[model samples]
Target: MKSSLRILAALAPLLLAACAPQQLVRHQGDAASLAQQDAREKQLAHADHWTLQGHLFVSNGQDGNGGTVTWTQNGDRYEFILRAPITGKSFRLTGGPDGAELDGLDGGPQTGPDAEALMRRVLNWDVPLGQLRAWVMGTRAAQGGVAQLSFDDNRLLSSLQQDGWDITYPAWDTTHQPPLPAKVFARKPPFMVKLSIQSWTMQ
Candidate 1:
């Protein structure tokens, strides 16, 4: 009985080592996965054409508005529709790199050199719609501006600052290829916009 007990005691250390949790292994694997995800995002930045349908909330110091937003991008040409359900008002914005045009529910077509300026002028909302095309996909816009970017534990974009607006992505839609921001918010003091993407498709 004494010899048997000694044998069991001798094997205890080996058994415990074999059953130890794989914490180090898991952390290393996670780091590799993060690197892969970062590479994928960088490649996805070149994608210029895609569609997104979502909801938007805007506060422009004077008033607050909530509505549905449908945005479509095809190369340099893009179209965005913002509809306010309560007021039954809908606005469509379409444009390219050189300029943009806005069609309000109550006014005629308004053209401008910039989409952000047009929105603020016509809709009384300060929204950076042009930059939002890239922002929604978790990347900085290409119009040449300084952007401060932040990443999550998984090396995914969590927040960014561009053109004086601070943007934050709280959740991501991992169900889609390359994954995109499920919910994003941008604030520049007097102006604030919240976007929630319900669907995303890439081409």
Candidate 2:
């Protein structure tokens, strides 16, 4: 426990280092990314509740698997629940950096390497479950990333960019719509994450 905390603590400063204003303003993506970041932040401040269900494919996208994710945010903190289907076996994980207990896992404090851990390092986002939930859904939280966001239809948060990484959302609903799956495409060379919106609803 102590070692994990120390590792995370040590990481905090490095993460902050990457968040210098210059990085955010200097992303190499086209103008669309900046516009989306701005637009997404604006929409997030107004949303009450949002849930995104989709097919999550990782590790080169050849896994041929799917999953559903639901996010609920009351305020600064939110809960992201993910259930993944891989090779006929199902696994679920719930919890964020700020949360003490993940809902459906039993073992020790998972102090090992995993996809989520990699994302935390690569993205430098360690907000509570709800905070990230909101950001992904278009809310701006305390994430230190050289990021820019853009929106489509001027409401639903559209795209985001951080540290040479970028996400482009193609399908978006403009008029305060629901049941819209905001697809975000991420690129970072050998690592890619493609998320598809399968369902959306208010809770």
Best-performing candidate as measured by TM-score = 1
Q: How do all models score by TM-score?
A: 0.72, 0.52
| Clashes per candidate, residues 3 or more apart or on different chains | 0, 7
Worst 10-residue lDDT window for candidate 1 reads 10-19
Error of 2 at 130 (Å): 8.2
Superposed model 1: Cα runs more than 4 Å off: 1-38, 114-117, 120-130
Q: What is the C-alpha lDDT of each candidate?
A: 0.61, 0.42
Estimate, for each residue in 1-203, the C-alpha lDDT of model 2 and write its tens digit. 33222222211111111111322223343566545555555644566665555655433222222345544544434444555443232333333344432333333333323324533643343423333344345444545455565544433344555545545555554434332335545454444455565566665
**RMSD of every prediction:** 20.9, 9.2
